[model samples]
Target: MLRRIPSQLAVALFWLLHWLPLPLQAVIGESVGELLYRFASRRRHIVMVNLRLCLPELDVTERQRIARAHFRALGRSILERGLLWWASAERLKRMIRLEGAERLRALLDDGRPVMLLAPHFLGLDMGGARIAMEFNCVSIYARQKNAVFDHWLFHGRSRFGDQQLLSRQDGVRGTVKAMKAGRPFYYLPDMDYGREDSIFVPFFGVPAATITGLSRLSRLTRAAVVPCVTRMLPGGGGYVVELGEAWADFPTADVEADTTRMNRWIESVVRTMPEQYYWVHRRFKTRPPGEARPY
Candidate 1:
């Protein structure tokens, strides 16, 4: 009942925000996210742990600063979802500021499916939808926890031509189908999902148990792999979605080797904006062979 209550209220708030001016709605979202971050103890600790792992070179003060900033960004992202999911198409187009559209366009123009890799940065859900609308098709792999929430989120995400695949069961098949149809698919390759079918990969010099799905998918589908990220601009203006070069000759015959290479690529992307990266996730929870879990 409690879960349903929040989601029900969220839907109500979504409609309410839609009626407000875009700028005012964004401000309300940012303010709410800030308030939650200031008061949420569990979330605060998760952010701290993520910052500590990624930026070990920083002093305590610097780490704290980054964590606080990251939380605020997260808040803004949560608040903006109302606009992204339910706002009129014209309004959403105005709220987002895009970069690297040419890169994506060029990839699609080549007549090959592109693997859109994005870290769990701010505005990714909205940015993915924007890209999918432009390309006409996008398949994204997502982790599903609750059946009810999954149903709702999938519907919302698909509103902009982005298809959501559940990571546990249908993800691989869904991705393959998208590739065969020559459509771009998006995946977040950073999170740790236990020890099964995973290999030790260096992220920030620590061996994090990373998912090999992206590399495996590339190998299976022969799709071009491209890294993309969505970042929230300072002062709560809007978001920028950036794309980088396609992974050259990726997904060699060897799955483990290719997966390691892909992790290195993700590490480079995350290093560029360390704070915006999703540090609150328990990325290193699963230990390597014969090693103790970090947490």
Candidate 2:
């Protein structure tokens, strides 16, 4: 009953936020996110540690500044979730300024399924919805956490012909099915799932456990794995979604080799804009034998 009550309240609050003007709603949302971050000291520490490791070249002062900005951005993202899920199609469209969309469209025109891989960046939810509207349907692999939140997010993502599949037992099969049906599916291969379904790879000179699902799916379905990112423009000018080159070939006979190569590709893309990447995640939590966790 407690869980059910919170879920109901969340739904009510979502609609309430949706009814407000976008700017006003964003202000409120960011404020709430900032409050949460202030209280969540453990999480803040984890984010700081992650940032420091990824940007070892930066001195303490520079790293702290980046971390503070990242937290603020995260707060904005949290508050914008309701607006993203419930806003009208036109409103959502206006919220972002897209780039390299033609690159994605061109890939789809080739009659092959495309795998869009991105690190957790700004306006991810909104950006995904926009892409699904412009291109074909997208199937995204989402990690299932709270049932209530999952239910809400699933419907929210699917509202624009984008399906959300849980990253569980049938996730791989479902993803492959979607790709074979010529749908563009999305996956974030930056985090550490575990040692079982992942392998150690170099990310910012540190070993990180990276998911191999993208490589496996591409090989099985013959889909094109393309690196993409949504970066926030300065002065709150909205977001720009950029597309990079597609993977020429993936999923060779050796899964480890293929996974490592794929992680390297992701690392290269992330290096270009380190601040945009989600430095809050403990990417090195699951290290190899006799190795300590970086964060």
Candidate 3:
């Protein structure tokens, strides 16, 4: 149909762009990001608001600098996703290096249920793609409004391994069932999904409405929470998927406390690479009773 032309063109462009060298792609992507930073007023405002709330110590100018840098990272991520979608398994493996992978393998070897606590980072898709190459994993994703784009997104992600993509609307029961069956869950729990099944937890000292699914999932499946942080190296340098040691004695009797601990750990990681974090998202959108929304 006529309405699908734009989406078709976008996919074609991504396919074309994937053929270029990474360094050249990085240059073009950053340039695109600079343009977005200047012209995309709404997204720029959201990023600024997030920076203002989360990194209050940074002055206006510093926050602006970080915001611009974040847009550049986001731009690179969008462009590089083409590589993830079409590049060969060998080529992708060469670019994405997994550090501390044994930690995850050890848990699985011990017949333990594993949950990969992947936060929102620019290289999230690349990291997930890399993991999918090695393990038959399960992840939850929201469907895109555009049917053309949605089909490609699902195809790109499911291209490698026996990866299973569950719709966000499918809920935790299906994901829990997957986790119980020895499939490692690539879980991204650091987003504001409103008040349902979420509690107000302090993220960067701000009360963020975070889903309590991490603790609940762990409790139900007895999964070990291993933090997976995917970092995009500067310029043409490839990505590194760093797997941290699994948390011991996690998901205690109190779900609130467990969620708080998860947020604190995510905050620490974001501090290390502020520009790569998903700043464009309205992280603090949902507010507690009597509190105003930040975005």
C-alpha TM-score for every candidate: 0.87, 0.85, 0.97
| Model 2 stretches with alpha carbons more than 4 Å out | 1-7, 20-26, 138-145, 162-167, 249-258, 268-273
User: What does candidate 3's lDDT look like per residue over 1-295, in tens digits?
Assistant: 2233498887888899998988888888888788788888899999999999999999999999999999888888887878988999998898899888788888888888999999999999999999988888999978999998788888888999898889988978888888877789999999888888999989999999999988998998899999999999997788999999999999799999999999999999999999999998999889988988777
Q: How many clashes show up in model 3? A: 0
Worst 10 residues of 1 by lDDT: 1-10
Instruction: Count clashing residue pairs in model 2.
Output: 0
lDDT of 1 by residue, 1-295 (tens): 1234576676676667767765676677667656656777676777777667767889989988787777766766666676766776776777676677787778778777778888777777877777766766555546457665566567667777545454555547766776767677777777887777678877777888877877787777778888888877666566777877787878788777887777777677777777677766788778777887554
lDDT scores in order: 0.72, 0.71, 0.90
Residue-level error in angstroms, candidate 1, position 281: 1.1
How far does residue 72 in candidate 3 sit from its true spot (Å)?
Answer: 0.7
Question: Which run of 10 residues does model 3 get worst, by summed lDDT?
Answer: 1-10
Structure candidate 2, residue pairs in collision: none
Using lDDT as the measure, name the better of candidate 1 and candidate 3. 3
lDDT of 2 by residue, 3-68 (tens): 344776877777787776656765665566566567767777887788777778889888767766
Clashing pairs in 1: none
**Residue 245 CA error for candidate 2 (Å)?**
3.2
TM-score of 1: 0.87
